[model samples]
Target: MAEPSPPSFPPGNYDLSSVDLDDDRYEVKQSAIRNKYTIRDSTGNVVLRGKQKMFKMKEEFPFVTDNGEDAFTVKAGGIMDVTGNYAITDTGTSEEVIILGEDFSLFVENWTIRDPDTGEALATIQSKSGFSRPSDTLSPL
Candidate 1:
């Protein structure tokens, strides 16, 4: 059987300009066996945050929403997993928004985020998930 279609937005796209990284603090152990990165905003508000699991061969970075309401995590092995409600506001009547990813090659599986009204996809932000190599591309998390 064919897979179900992804949900759609109402009319306009969700504006991500309001999204900004305020500030961040991280700690690395002497052994470098484990590391934690916590990001906060200018007002000390955590916008996006994550943790790293280091190993001899590879590392994994998993992040979640600051409020802990929703989670969007990425692994060092190129695995991205997103869950929970991502908030957005629009002046328009349409209650839908678009979640644009950094690239097309990124893979998303076992992920779900949607608009409460229509149960449609508001946005999907992930590149790839699973045991894979990391890319040189640099972009905000």
Candidate 2:
């Protein structure tokens, strides 16, 4: 009897002419912008969520209110002390920003306001291009 042939793999000459490389071209474009600010207490509880604006120019970063009031300011080239927990979101870029406080308790205590979550200090809050506040002055997204 003739020897049985071994199993053969699929042929290499497959046709792929129907696949379109540029099919989904209308996806929403996202920009890189700092937009929203959310503060949480040490107990992992969210305390504050609002529209906080940051100004960054010439390597200096400062946190300000939506209407140009000083919320938090830091020196240029200095290390930023991020305390507690906070989240920042950029709607334009669809990026979720998170800041985790570290062992620098002294620095965080100095800048942040009273109240547990609010008491935590923020490090550098730099403003990227095309960042803006909403009309309601609540959240960035």
Candidate 3:
């Protein structure tokens, strides 16, 4: 598969350039007891950390940089995405930039990264080997 292009974001408070998207080898470590998670590089440097509020009618995860700057958020709310579809929004502008939705597969875990506006499939992510998808493009985003 070709490298999956990230979803386009309009001019707003959302800034992708501020993020360290240079490395795709970062690992995600989730807290077993809660919704908190930390993203670390292969060398074990914390990249980004985030958590969601408990007891919400809908699920949302807001992430921030190690320096504590708001980065982005993953939200599941709209009628069209209330089930397995999620919107990754820019926290500063509250604009939905991308979507992660569940796509059915017979044997393995299947999911997709999509454009929230056009509903175009940007990438198909499968659990080929525990997050070892063919392309590591989506990791830093």
Candidate 4:
């Protein structure tokens, strides 16, 4: 079967200039054992860091800033949950940003991000083959 054409957006319809840019670029470095990950910037300055510890029941990974301030955390859920089942929370306000779940199909595997409060889908990401080109425009779901 022929593949569907990629979606397109008209020119000047969206303003790309006013979008906020991330000033600090983070580079993640993981240890050989995958127990620790350090985030550094372009100048080799540590910006954020994370550490994980193994346990019998559950495992939790917390990411912190250079000053040892709590940034966010990821905690594993029960085994009965889906593949991407985990709880991710922001440490500052104690708000959950994204709860991930996986959906499998015959041709694609989808990773969905849902709102923790209402359980509504916020975004869906699908794995694509390396030879496939990305669409130039994005539309709201």
Task: Quote model 2's TM-score.
Answer: 0.19
Poorest 10 consecutive residues of model 3 by lDDT?
Answer: 132-141
Indicate the worst ten consecutive residues by lDDT in candidate 4: 132-141
- Per-prediction TM-score, please? 0.29, 0.19, 0.65, 0.50
Report the C-alpha lDDT of model 4 over 1-141, residue by residue, as the tens digit.
985443332343211222211333445555644447887776787877778765324546787777787778876566323244667777765666667776644444466767676777766666553321112011000
The global Cα lDDT (0 to 1) of model 3 is 0.65
lDDT of 1 by residue, 22-139 (tens): 2233221111123455655546655655555544233334445565433343323233322223333322332334222233233332234455456665544342335222232221
Q: Write the per-residue lDDT of candidate 3 for residues 1-141, one digit (tens) a residue.
A: 886564554444234544655554556655654558898887888878998676555667788888998888877755323237878887766778778886544344467877778987766666544443322222211
Candidate 4: where are CA atoms >4 Å away?
1-21, 42-44, 79-82, 100-114, 118-141
TM-score of 3: 0.65
lDDT of 2 by residue, 67-138 (tens): 443333222222222233333322333232223332332222222212222443424332222332332122
Clashes of each: 11, 1, 0, 0
Clashes in model 2: which pairs? 31-92
lDDT of each: 0.38, 0.30, 0.65, 0.56
In terms of TM-score, which candidate is stronger, 1 or 3? 3
Off by more than 4 A, model 1: 1-33, 54-56, 77-141
- Clash pairs (backbone) in predicted model 4: none
Candidate with more favorable, higher lDDT: 1 or 2 = 1
Please give the ranking of all candidate structures by TM-score, highest first, separated by commas.
Answer: 3, 4, 1, 2
Candidate number achieving the greatest lDDT relative to the actual structure = 3
